[model samples]
Target: MSAVTAPTKGTPAHRRSRARGPLLSKRLRMAGLYLAGAAVFLFSVFPVYWMVATAFKPVSEIFSGTPSLLPGTPTLEHFDRVINGELIPGVSFWRFFANSLTVTLASVLMGAVLSLLAAIAVARFRFRLRTAFIMVLLVIQMVPMEAMIISIFINFRQLQDATGVQMLGNLTGILIVYTAVSLPITIMMLRGFVAAVPKELEEAAAIDGAGNWTIFWRILMPLVAPGLVAASIFAFITAWNEFIVALTFLGRSTDYYTLPLTLSYYFGRYGTEWGSIMAASTLLTIPVMIFFLFVQRRMVSGLTMGAVKG
Candidate 1:
């Protein structure tokens, strides 16, 4: 055998190049991945950035012959117009905001509570028609809302006529509809969360002289709080952004209009008010962003935690 030789401090160019090749390739691959991620991020965020930029731009810049990435002079005139001017003949922006707030809160609250209770029953108990109930939920969720809206409206009108509850032309009608629409999926999602919690915890609590209610509220609820927050976010967004049902139910009553309905006002036969539209759209996104900021951690955790057991 020839004399064994090790690579010294000063190695040949080819050897050095071969040794460094993988590191250099790895760095290049990382750079390429980062560039790809940046491209996707820009693609996703550009529309939102454009909407906000347009919102701050003056009417002259908005309608300019040449397009601009930045506003020439930013102005709050569009926001002022949206806020100060009436979207409907007699209704103010605050009125519509309040209506949306009330409806969203009520539906989320009612739907969340109902979903939690139903999910617990389905997850923990052995009863007749349990599997059937789950199947029904799945079937109902598969059916599109458009297919059922006509029947719902007809039935709601009859109910209103019989009960004098004004179910067809009021916030209550929409609130009920929103809750029902969100229930099936909410229940399905929460069932996974409920099943993930150990029954041993409840048994231990019971052994320690805790009642059923105490065990449920103190031990179980805190564990599933993330799931609750996630479900509430879904319910809140659904109720907040629902347009067709709100428009159908509210009809010509502008007093009960939500933010989504206000976007329609900026369009007219003569010309569309692009500036005011963007401003109002920007304003509309703020509440959702604020809500997401508060609950984002919980939402992510809830989805992960529930998925573990499911």
Candidate 2:
């Protein structure tokens, strides 16, 4: 009979084919990519990790000759010192915290309001010197704060003299400085966002009898909310972490200290308290992280806005 087609025995060579090797090669390439990314992440994150690790270490362990990737025994003592007002003998952390909160919040809020309004005008309306005004802002931004510090200090001092106010060492003074410094960039940035929203929509609103303010509030603001969020985060971070101006203006007033200035308490003529300093540094980073988390969604959306070409 058909001597049978007993299952074709042509198979030994075919069975041994090296198909899996190519799949394994692809897996190896994927693994290599994963390793490379992990290396970069670890490299970037290590210093921040070390700072927090060092912060939690005991004073004795911190100064020990051997370096450590992880502290042997983490202690809350240093943070307790900061909380208890013993980190710096005379500085009041709560008072400084309050000052920072008030100044940062006020400056960010006022800047957002003023800058958004200016951005709408610049983006939607044509006026004299409009281009020149934008160019002037760019040039002013190019000038380093160090160069302007003296002039700003003098100007604020004059304001204090004229108003009989402590413009050089108070919340009002710091807020004004932050607002002015942050406004130019904020306005420029929001201008693009305002420009992105179609003018036709605004005209439609106007035709429908909506007033300028109503159209802005109902139609425009929500459309550019992402940009507003991004700008607020930028302004908040800039003002919150500013050390030079704060040091220059708020130096004499410990009560006016922001978190960054609070770290100066750890410095001593004899030797710096590295442990407490690290702890303070760790604490200083927390607010920034929180602020970023709060704005992260809007940041992503704002970044995505550039994808809209028209």
TM-score of each: 0.85, 0.82
Model 1 regions more than 4 Å off: 1-25, 268-271, 293-310
lDDT of 1 at 260: 83
How many clashes does the backbone of model 1 have? 0
For residues 156-241, write the lDDT of model 2, one tens digit per residue: 89988998988887777778888888888888779888998998998999999999789978999899998898889988988989
Indicate the residue-level lDDT of 235 in model 2: 88
Clashes of each: 0, 0
- In candidate 2, stretches whose alpha carbon ends up further than 4 angstroms from where it belongs are 1-29, 203-209, 268-271, 294-310
Cα RMSD, each candidate: 7.7, 9.6
Model 2 lDDT on a 0 to 1 scale:
0.79
Q: Write the per-residue lDDT of candidate 1 for residues 185-204, one digit (tens) a residue.
A: 88877887898899899889
Alpha-carbon deviation at 116 in model 2, angstroms: 0.9
Best by lDDT: 1
Cα RMSD, model 1: 7.7
